[model samples]
Target: MKKITVFWGCQIPGRLTFLEKSTRLGLAALGYEINDIPEFGCCPEKSLIKNEDEKLWLLTAARNLALAEREGYPLVVACNGCSSTLKTAYVKLKGNPKLLAEVNEKLWEFGLKLGGSLKVYHLIEFLADEVGAGVIKQRVQKPLRGLKIGVHPGCHQNRPSPAASFEDPLNPRKYDILVQALGATTVEYQSKLMCCGNNLTLAGKLDDGWRMARVKIQELTNLRADALTVTCPACFMQFDQKQALYARQGDILNLPVLTYMELLALALGIEAEELNLKEHRVDPSPVLRKAGIINEPLPFNEEVLKRCLTCGACEYDCPSARTGVMSPQGIIKRFLNGEIEELINSSEIWECVECHTCLEYCPQRFGMEKVFTWLKHQAMVRETYPNSLKSGYEMFVKTGRLAKIDDRQRQKLGLPSLSSQEPRQFVEKLL
Candidate 1:
């Protein structure tokens, strides 16, 4: 079996043991031999310590890396912040002899020197690149279908390109690809790439941190996303804890925030209790139901569904309905009247562009867009979709992007090179 030193970092073991538990179980299920190092301290946390003392930060991170070197095992970090700090330190010490010597001089007190040779990997990068999403999908005993997950790839995961150049900083898709591989739809929210605001809390600006988390939770809630998935424990805490804190004030966000590993463990047939999901601030029962992990059906407000059927408010806001043959209200009405077969047989159900305009404009807050989505899923399972729809789906399933950027046109306009397309190979197999 493949082996690597698993760095649980500080937060996971201290406050987020659920994340650590799920990560260990998930990785082991994926056939990795996890070598635990109890000697490792905090990745010393870059934002807090590095800004305060650069020298101390470098020496501390270098010590951790040197230990991994002595163990003769590459490091696999579970926390994005930890990975960011370690990777940045590795690049700096390895690239600069004088800096490495200075750090090594300090480390020699503990009989350790900065080896500057061991490689480090974030857990997400390891799974996306090494374990491969294709193999992961094959191992899924319970696919998280019928659930919409909002992915929050924390800022430190793939930023500071010189240190963490494994993924595109501006448009990272590895998290989204992994979510899709679990058979859940990735919901696109406005604040998908925004900071989780844990830094603000750490900086003693508690309200500001809550405000940042609130904005994202509100957006994801509005989009009707079932859960918010994250790779970092800090981001997970920001969303999970803050959401619960706000709820105590009567402002209920109610979105279940889960670490990617926790979600993966669930899909790998690990029980919810084993993953310590109940310890989460927000209850994940609704999300579990939607994912079919629980044996209960998700409750739908019949009055709201009925109100949506009668009100054509969504149709006016739908771009596809405005340009195409069918309206959003028409699809809902047909489904309500038990014309499911006709709706499935027709191409009107597939005409939705999934722009989510109806969701935004619906006064009842529950729109027919979700109804259309369910219909589309049924159509897909029945293989009754239109040829054009099939061709587009096939193309997207084959290529991560619907269409490639015209490099020639970009060059003529003197634009910078296009972002990385590394997601194509893994995403194709995922779909």
Candidate 2:
């Protein structure tokens, strides 16, 4: 089992306990045991405190890291704000030993010294890049197949890019990848990358903050998403509680908001009733009901699909993949998007030669060959296998030949004449 530390920043432990519960439950399901630190104080709320007194912010963040450093496990954070704050401090302290000494000077009185060895990870980063979508998919007991989730990969998670080093800082996909790993579809909107303006609210710009959140909410409302998923507590509050206030005043935005951890926990088979979702001002029942039903279990190892989603190594070695007409990644991507019926119906699945060439190039040693084989099995079960394939099978059964012997080319190459008599005798005996 993998062991890690969770830095549940102030907001979650103090106000949003449900997010904590879901995160712990989900990570535990993924084979992680959290080593908690009672000494952690705060991530220091960078927006309001950092610019005013960066040293104090750095000092507090350094102290927190120092507290967790002794455990020597990678620290995972749930909120994007906390993630950015800690990472920035980590980057700053590591780059400037003088600053580290100054922070350590202040921390010595508290009997704490910042060693700066602890690796920090935002939860989405840990899930996608570390634990991997493959392991998450392997643990999924119920996939959120039918519900369309609107992902709010809040800005702080990747902004100030040098510090975070997350996947695709500008156009992030790790959140979408985490969501899709649970078997739900993610929708695109115009303001997908917009800031939630929580910092504006904290900076005494409540009206401006609400307006920014309102526009994104309205866009998603127009898009008719089943629910919104966020990676930040601030964004969650902006959409959930703030929107709740609007409902009381008769605005009634009617969109349920959830954090990525909560969705992951639910997908990992934790009951919705146990998650304390009642704390949300907006109701999550509609989404829960839509996604609550467990679909028929996957027939193959789901880890294969998860690992296959990111790999195209096989495409380089396969003749069919080189044609560019039927790429393996395309088929797996569509399959991950819950488009299996559409894919199984298309002629694309039949195009493979079952040559096992892809197995040679695949990094995981399992290749698109398994996917093609699975599709073939489904095709046979559904009577969708093409007539040409059926004729080939029948030809093999009756005469031990799929087609007439093409010995002319063989003769031209100075090969020997083809002999079918021995094969026919062998086929008769097998029958």
Candidate 3:
């Protein structure tokens, strides 16, 4: 068994202890020697601190690496952000002598030196590559059969490609492969490679961050995905917290977002209570019931849905509203004014492009998009769509693209080939 120092970065230990718990349970089950050093501080999280002070970022990260080096064990990080920071610091200090000297001078006062022996590994990659998916599959006391999981690798896990060499940066397969070994099917969805938008929130673009999460959630919902699995704490917070926040404002996603470790623990036959499923904002009961992991269903809280009607910010900024065919605000007003039948019958509901702009802009953080989405579903059930809409749907189903891309024309223009195949495949799976 290989011994490694587990760096349970600030987020995990401070807030997401469930992730920490699951990670320990899964890793222990795998028979790895895990060591926890109290001296290890924050990976210092690369985004905010690094931007503010580069030297401080390097110093702090170097200190963490020094602690792991002193232990003579490679650092295994559960958070993608922490892995990126620590790994980047390791690569930088080893390659740049001057910078390493500067950092070592700072560490010398504390009886620590940034050493060349320290290596950082994201826990997901460690499990996939080092532990081997075969060993994991063999250890599965309970396979997650008949479950459809959407994997969110988060941005930092496989980027700054030279530093994080474990997985492909663009099209990662390790997370998907790891989950599949547990007997669950990974669902393909749109923007599967995009960031979870948590960083945007830190940058004060709260709506933009939620928009990133909302789009993915909407696509997953369309795919009828059972649950979403993420390896990063920031991504988990974005999906889990924002999804719950949206649920409170009547935009109910109801998709249980699980950390990869949590999912792994479940496959290892760990009970829901042990994994702290209840701590999650969105209820995991739907996923639990689907997996036959739980018998009793959790009750839905209707009070959370009562708040979205008052906030019309989503409608005010809606592009569809500018067309005068009934805005999100107007639809909500009509519903509140006892015109539910008229609102459902109106073709304006279908005009929503599902851009999720409304969801993003709402002050309450949940918008009229859910209301319009429900109406659109009702229209589909009633077969009340216009001829143009029917034609567009038929075209997409037939050709797998909203509009054809002429590969010959691109070739003639000396341009690179358009990457439409992957998206087309996603569309096929989604449809």
lDDT at residue 299 of model 1 (Cα atoms): 39
**For model 2, how does the per-residue alpha-carbon lDDT over 2-114 read when each residue is reduced to its tens digit?**
88988988889999999899888888888899998888888988767898998888889888888888788999887788889989889999999988898889989999887
User: Each candidate's TM vs. the true structure?
Assistant: 0.70, 0.67, 0.68
lDDT, each prediction: 0.83, 0.83, 0.79
Stretches of candidate 3 exceeding 4 Å from the true structure: 296-431
- Model 1 agreement with the true structure over 227-306: per-residue lDDT tens digits: 99998988988999888988999988799998899899999999888987888999998788656575432235656778
Candidate No. with top TM-score? 1
Rank ordering of all candidates by TM-score, starting from the highest: 1, 3, 2
Once superposed on the true structure, which residue ranges of model 2 sit more than 4 Å away at CA?
A: 293-431
What lDDT, from 0 to 1, does candidate 3 have?
0.79
The per-residue C-alpha lDDT of model 3 at residue 166 equals: 82
Q: What clash pairs does model 2 have?
A: none
User: Residues 37-121, candidate 3, lDDT per residue (tens digit)?
Assistant: 9988888877789988988898999999888889988779888999888888889889999989988998999999876977678
Cα displacement (angstroms), candidate 3, residue 184, comes to 0.2
Inter-residue clash pairs, candidate 1: none
